[model samples]
Target: MSSADSSSSGFVLLGVEDVEDCALSNEGEGSLPLDRFGYVSDLVKKGNHAFRQSRLDMFEQAINYYTRANQIKPNDPIILGNRCATYLRISQFLKLRDSSDSEDRPLSGLDPTIHAELALKDAEKLGEIQSNTVRPFILKASALLLLEKYELARSTVISGLQVDPFSNSLQGALQHLEKMQAGNNGRRSHTKPERTDDFDCTLCLKLLYEPITTPCGHSFCRSCLFQSMDRGNKCPLCRTVLFISPRMSAVSVTLNSIIQKNFPEEYAERKAEHDGLTNFGADLMPLFVMDVVIPCQKYHLHIFEPRYRLMVRRIMEGSRRMGMVGIDPTTGSFAEFACEVEITECEPLPDGRFLIEVEGRRRFRIIRSRDQDGYRVAEVEWVRDLQLPDGSQERVDLLESTNNIAKHASSWLTRARQASQQDRSRYEKLLGLERMMPTPRDPERFSFWLATLTNRTPREKLDLLQLTNTRERISRALIYMRSGELGCRLDLNTITNAPPYTI
Candidate 1:
């Protein structure tokens, strides 16, 4: 089998799409009795053949062949590497596949997450067997990236670089990690010094934004250094090979502060330029693509990724708002509808993560979307329920429906609280729901508030966000509340993943 770079440039698989060549000989296996080694070779050849096909089912077949080969030659680097690559490839395919398709014809065996976890195991074993080769580091790092363990992925790449300083793949992976930290926005500088070319980045010749001072005692804009490294893994000015990765290279705080204090006007201009990229316009907002949130929903989020950290910092400086969205599996993109949320509280942790409380305010439909730096940005149109005429029959009916649901919800809460007294988590959920109860006078907000009392899938919540009829929305909420009450009688875990109820 020929080993080359795969999609992420880390796996030691054959070709990107197909098997171009195979070296394992099966000449005598058909005609003669084969030994253990001969049989192992034959299995690997078959695995390679299947892997080269690049179809979802074929990838699974390749994994099966590799698994059999591994049984014959346990911990073999070749077998382990090939299998790891295959697992990652299949997981990627499944993740991008339409959700409806998977639901319609579900895989009978392992899911995407399981496949990625299995790949990580194989990568770890391969690393132990081939400690001196760059391939092990590549495979392990690739698996970690697929698993969304950003810090671990960076560490793996940094370690791989220690083994092979000139490895392009490792360097590329490190650069990718840095971009994940945030966009091109740089830190503010302080100090009093005569402004000159010294504050300028050699690459952009502009005032330094997020400046980094390399070990070689050279300073350059963080984005400039990484962009230069993209073409060649070396210092732009010097021929020195830099060892600094995202974890290792941090912005020069003192220098950054000096620049900010000395040139206030220029700094403000630069800030505006950067903000223009992250925050598009009055109707445009930066998007956090993770979960489905609805108006009146309040929750806490752990923001660790660099890009989001940067996005949060920018929001804190301005309107303190952003959009929360979930990917639509059918389109493999942002769902059409999302909720705008305001950051009610933001506590920046010592480790650069944010513990923030956000409350959903308004629902919006994405008119268009685009990639801004490493995250997503979009222009959206706000959504609101169509109001019923005052004193009309429909309005009166909605009020009656709301009151009935509210009474039912209250009775359910009382029982749930009594049952959950022995279970702190469930009790806490009930308490949260009680605190979020809205008066029946506002049937529209009341409907969304009612839905938060139960745990529903993102798809289900997205459906709620798209509803413009208060009565219909309240009816659906009543159904879910009733269902949860039933589920709780048998098992308490059916309550929202947390204490139940928050849109």
Candidate 2:
């Protein structure tokens, strides 16, 4: 209630001081002391006095006193109701305060929305404590109205009407809610303005999606802004240096809402367009140009570049999968063969970097590739080793070779573990690779797993990916394993100043 309404019937404050004192005196006759009643009454009276004063700070002081009184007399309906009203009054005052008049004198405290929310909480508690009273509903309706929840306010008023059919306060609140709804409907019914560039992002020349306004007063789509920032830390239009990153930036909520409410169809199309790039399709995949990863191999990646950071966010939102590839030393472009990896864990840091764990799933050949935003996207065809005919002599021979390779791999790991005692990193890698050993029955998978036993250059790994014959790949891995075993033995023999051991 406003100070102007203090003399009118619209303003009301219940006087419960005498009733509280009388009840406390009755309790005193049982076990309570008279001094306790005096202290509680003093607090309630102080709250009422401060609430009546025409100042914002006085409202806070009133809430403070009411809170103290409530602590002494828990669940007091009178205290809760008064505090709810005070919260509502202070919130309304802050929202309606004249900005021009306060240019020289700034007000500092809780924002209007927070105060309204607090009032709503207290009003809800009061309703539970005194369900049969009309006052709780009235307080609740008023708070909801202040918070711009007109439908809930109307429902609260109707519930109050059911309790007291002739309540003037509830009838007035219900009418106010109806009028607000009609006004909103009428405004929305008006003819929309012609399409213009005002709602379009300058960077992409399209309707803005998740629009972000730079400090220099220019707006662009969030992805477009950061993608351009990848080239330089400056605004595209103004060329002004911007120290802001996507992690530190926020969307322009008001502008985005306005565009959504005004041109919903265009906004939806813009969202679909953005989603298409992020969640491209089943046959298409985004490529992370990094290293040669084969199936069953797992590793972690630290993403810090602006483009990859943006890519990681999109991947996490969609399939959590991407193609990991290496640059071809011959063509200076992405290798023709790449492996698909799925992100198992992604942790986004406060500084906008991502620490992600990805595991290689299968291989794919890039049929065609292009750039989207700042990263590579490709139309790929899944690659698998050509299988030998079932029950054929070639298949039988392949199985025998795979089993022999597996035995050799086991013996090599045991010897490497004994030799790598002083090298903690190498020992840990060996142990991890050992745990992931595949079965010899699936020769294709076993070949890839076996290739991991020895460190190969990117070119050698790329050659492994290009091979389609399982027996040839298995033989290639056996060569690497034997060479690695021989190198370990040679190192030991040299360290001991003895003859080299045979593998």
Candidate 3:
């Protein structure tokens, strides 16, 4: 059968009317008033309709209805269970949108993460009341997954599966986990067995970053493969012919859903902050300033292509400031919002190429776009000041730690430069020092830094960029960085075929 047909066949829909019937049947017990049952049914319909229309306000209204329904039929499994599902869905949609728009500004205001956490707590309480219900368990598992508590998601799903062995959804989730585990294992097993030296690349380790895998399945950092590829499109180890196009591996959707469910509070907060930043300029017009958007957190961008070269020249001639809007690789469309970037460094290369560095300043959203002399121009509105959550000092501390780590790394680089006695330009020296400096006012910078230090995949980094609050972003970043550091260090022996030592 086709995928659509299979999907339609796999799950049964339980409508508001069915829910009402169930509640009405229980009304004969005199436990709930008949009017309350009708009210709940109406509320459920409204909530479902609002969800279908993507009306956030309506979802809130539905919540009120469900809340009242609970009062009328206290401890009713169906009421509690369905409400949990609705809340989870609302939370997920909000988070997805927030992440998509996060790069625009520093987030402030309400704590989405805390709200999500509360919602999950409610779900968990309902799950305990109705221990046999699979829906609550699934919702809880999903919430944990959103929080990046993978082990918890895994165990929860397993427990649910034990209760209902033939649940296709549970089975599908398990399979996805297995695939991730296998992929991770394959990477570990393919490394050279006898190199036996710490700090050596597992695939030529030399401090792995911007890792890319060859068609023959060998992986190497971008810098390592750049020169090698200049010679030929073949794997250095296996001589397998390579495909030049870059391909992103598909992430596990089920896993992502779990993360969303588990860590609603963090996810929501980050998303809101990201939206504020990215959508800052969405309402303004007549954008006279040029803009540049860079996705790579490190390295100077070399603009050589005819189209971009012309674009940059026009910006330099027109205005030193430009709008840098990130483009979604999958969609090839500019993100809903962009950031104002100041050109800090620029140089002309020998081959008519230009090397440049731009610093992020404020977030904006594009109101409209126009083609100008073979380049793109966008009108935008600037975002207002972002406000932080109460007790966000801890988040500030995490950012400080990241800055400190970068400073230490810069010091090491400085010593290396001094020892080598290589003559360096003033600009190069400045750039080197700046690499270790964090963007003090930019929360997105913290998120980017966390993604870098944690060795998170590009997709994961993108998710970070989408968050809305500085505190939540920093919190998530710290967690990812610490966990990644530990994971990378723990597997160092296996990765490099060497004995372990303290960093």
Q: Is candidate 2 or candidate 3 better by lDDT?
A: 2
Each prediction's whole-model lDDT (CA): 0.70, 0.72, 0.48
lDDT of 2 by residue, 1-503 (tens): 32112212122222211112223222422232344346567788888888888577788788777776654565577777788888777767655655443334434223454466667877899899789988888788777766656678789889988999988777766665676578667755445656789888897899988888876789999878767765666789999766554323446655776788889988989989878877878889999999988887877899988789779778865788999999999899889998999985444443456677787888999999988767989999999999889999989888886787688778888788778878856755665576668888999999899888777788888988999987767766666665666674222223332212211
lDDT of 1 at 113: 42
User: What's model 3's TM-score?
Assistant: 0.32
Top candidate on TM-score is 2
Worst 10 residues of 1 by lDDT: 9-18
TM-score of each: 0.49, 0.52, 0.32
Per-residue lDDT of candidate 1, residues 399-451 (tens digit): 88678768878887777778776785565556556656788888999989988
The C-alpha RMSD in Å for every predicted model, in order, reads 20.2, 18.8, 25.8
* Clash totals, every prediction: 15, 0, 46
Give the deviation of candidate 3 from the true structure as CA RMSD: 25.8
**Residue 30 lDDT (model 3):** 32
> Which regions of candidate 3 deviate over 4 angstroms?
1-30, 98-112, 184-503
